[model samples]
Target chain A: MPRHELLTGNEAVAHAVAMAKADVIGIYPITPQTTIIEEICNLAANKTFSPKIVHVESEHSAMATIIGAAFTGVRTFTATSSQGLALMHELLHWAAGGRLPIVLANVNRAMAPGWSIWTDQNDSLSQRDTGWMQFYCESAQEVLDTIFLAYRVSEQVLIPSMVVLDAFVLSHTSEPVEIPDNETINKFLPNFTPSFKLDIDNPCSFGALLRPQFYQEVRHKLNDAMSEALIKINESDKLWKQLTGREWGIVTEYRADDADYLFVTSATTASTAKPVIDKLRKEGLKIGLIKIRVFRPFPFEQVKKYLTKCKRAIIFDRNISYGHHGIFAQEIKSALYGVKNSPEILCYTGGLGGKDITPQLIEETIIKGTKTKLNGSLFEWI
Target chain B: MPIKSYEVRFHGRGGQGVVIVSKIIGYAAFLNKSYIQCFPEFGVERRGAPVKAFLRISNQQIFIRSSIEKPDCIVVLDPMLLSQHDTLAGASSDCLLIINSRTADLQIQKSFNNICVVNASDIAVQNGLGTATTPIVNTAIAGAFAQATEIIQMKHLEKAILKYSPAKIQENVKAAYQAYNTVSKPIPLK
Candidate 1:
């Protein structure tokens, strides 16, 4: 039986990482995300776990160190937040291009212009093109479950993965978590016996300079692998449900059957939107909610499958893309383009830098979605 | 329908172990086999500045992640923060206010009929739990909260404090016990 414990999302991730028996963890402390690595360090010191804790000075070095460990066929882990993640931009491409299967926990914080360390998706959303498989978690249990799911998918596909959660909302928040014991986790995730590695017995060039012809082919193979990863996520999710008693796939649907208008959200906002939807429904409104669980490999099929019936869809993006629009809303619009009688996508970008997206604001946004729900690139400051 | 979840908020300065108060309550609830969730007021917390933390304890699972708009009980670790911030706003008329002070403010006692006052800082100081100038009142406040609202027991609070404390375990336990004994019973609303 899975034991129930009160754990912060950070602590949950740490517990999962420890259960996975990662070989190396090179972490640099930053707000919100700092506690994840700190908890891991404490667990390593107090428990029987013995992952090599690489004390790195900067996030760049942390990413770089993980790259070295992963290259040598070790399951590696690392964590960071906004500016810390931003500092590792160049190395992010390296891990992806090399297909390291490294897992990172990104506590999503607002990017620094006015210098705020609050909840927002801008940090991770900005790296959507970085080729790492991304999974957005709604709660502490989800954070714990998704780490193994991410590792399972990433290892099979041989690509890096990121598990993103809101800054203070999930990262700092404590919740009831169903902690699966190590023996159960071990059965699900075996040791990282790499198929290919850096060894004297098998010498081969790694990350060498290549021409466009070979590079294009490698990129195509990576693209094909992403489609396979979607299949892997579905399979692993089922197996996880069998092992534990809970599972969330690429996306989860709630009350969309009789809804005229639907609200789309991710991370903690999706959790908040649920109560609002229930309240509005009690008041005799036909509204529903769809939470995006997996963002990378985009999950367009799941999004379209759940949302095709609605008259309008409201995509809530906590981070702005500056001149372009909301990051998530832009993706939702693109996903719905070229479809016949598609639901309108109302783009609302609020809660940046940890601004509260109250249940009242969500109810109001549903009303606003009814008005602007008629499509196009709308950059609502809300 | 009966109450599904109980919302509790804590108001204190940054360095007063305000955030830990939520963890202690949640841990106790978890030990008692009830579902509990907690979080602090999202901010770049600085010492001596006002900070707030929230906790939700329920018999069933709690799924809401939003800020508690109307808290069922409010614990004021730094009683001065009651006026510095609207800690009492949006609370029910009969909502409980647990203050860490030598005596309950008459106005607050009148405004909130269900109120309890415990000299948490003095208890902490007497037990040498904090510096002479800055008395860390988190454990003491937890004890006061236990008596005023019965959310967590004093024994559980003391155990949690000691479990997390690297040094001065007895002192913290003493501070909490003192507050638990000294805190006035909550005065029910008329």
Candidate 2:
């Protein structure tokens, strides 16, 4: 039987890593993400988990350690936030390019200059082109369940995955979680038996420099693998649901099918929009919410399908693309390009550096979006 | 009718177990098969800084992952906080204020329609839960909250205290029970 217990998002991630039977975990402590490392270490000390916990000096070394461990055909894990994630930028590409299937939990936090420890999408969204699969979770249960699904999909496509949740908002908030037993997890995820590994017996050089003759081809193949991962990801989600009776779609639609207006967002912001949307609907407003769960291997078809019937879309983005509009707004516009009679999209960007996205604010956004002249401008700030 | 959702805010100093008390309430709600979320306002870490925590309980799965701006109930673990912060800023007239003071302040008494008071510091000291100077009043306050609100069962609250209390579980549990027994009726505003 699955055990029901209260756990923070970070603690849930640690539990998932342990249940996944990861052979190694790389750690460098940072606020909002420190509890994950602490819980993992505690689980190890209690003898309930037996992974080799590698305490590295920096996030770069943490990613490096995991990459090295994954090369040995072992399941590996690591976690970081904000600056720590920024420091691991180079190795993030290395892990994905090497096709290591290592899983990382990035507590999404705002980048620093003035200093902050709050929930924002800037950290993970900044790594958009890193080639790793990204899953933005709204709750602690999703944080736990997504890790298993990430590993399942990554191993099949030989791509790395990042499971993301909001800093402090989800990381520090305790929620009731149903922990899947080890036997059930073992059945769902087998040991990592990669066809390629850093074995002395075989003695093959991994990540060797490719000549100009073959570099582009290798890049094309990686892109093809990502396309293949889209299929594999859905398949993995279905399989997980069959086993655990829970599934978070690549793009989740909430009462969006026949709505005239839609609120599209990701992570905790998406969650915050739910009650607001419900209240608006009660007022007889044809408004709904679309939560973008999987950012990388972007669910283009699902997004397009949801937006087809809506008259307008109010996109709330926590991270702005600086010079450009909100990244999701940019992506959605790109997705809907050339489609006949697509909804006008109004992108409102704010909530950076852990500012609250309250229900009142959401309701106000809806009211403002309704009042705006159609196609006047696509970008605004809350 | 049962509450579809209830948002709660806890006001106290950093070292007085404000966060833990919210978690205990969350756990109690969870034990009843209700969805709950508990978190603290992110702040600079210190021993005596004014801090706040929040708890949300709902029969439905909670999807709003944001701070409670308009709380249905406010739990003040420190009476001193009432003078310093707008602890009742967003609370409605009918919103319940459960405080740890021996007596409600004159302004506070005039401010709310419903207020519940308990000498949680005295209860904690009597039970040896914390030092006399800085008594850990969270558990006692939580107990008073349970008594005043009648939202959480005393049995479930006891179980949560046992599971989440950092140290001296027996003392904490005793303090909670004593406060539950001695908490004042919901006094109307003067």
Complex DockQ per candidate = 0.60, 0.65
Q: Could you give the CAPRI-style class of model 2? A: medium
DockQ category of candidate 1:
medium
Q: What is candidate 1's lDDT per residue for A16-90, written digit by digit as tens?
A: 998888889998899989899989999999875899999989999999999999999999999999999999999
Model 1 regions lying over 4 Å from their true place:
A371-378, B1-4, B105-110, B131-133, B188-190
Candidate 1 clash pair list: none
Task: Provide the clash count, candidate 2.
Answer: 0
Superposed by TM-score, candidate 1 places the C-alpha of residue A358 at a distance from the truth, in angstroms, of 1.4
Relative to the unseen true structure, what is the C-alpha lDDT of residue B17 in candidate 2, on a scale of 0 to 100? 92
lDDT of each: 0.85, 0.89
Give DockQ: model 1. Answer: 0.60
Model 1 agreement with the true structure over B6-91: per-residue lDDT tens digits: 98988889899888877887786667777888998988789998888999898876767888888888888876766653778788
Off by over 4 Å in 2: B1-4, B104-110
- Whole-structure CA lDDT of model 2: 0.89
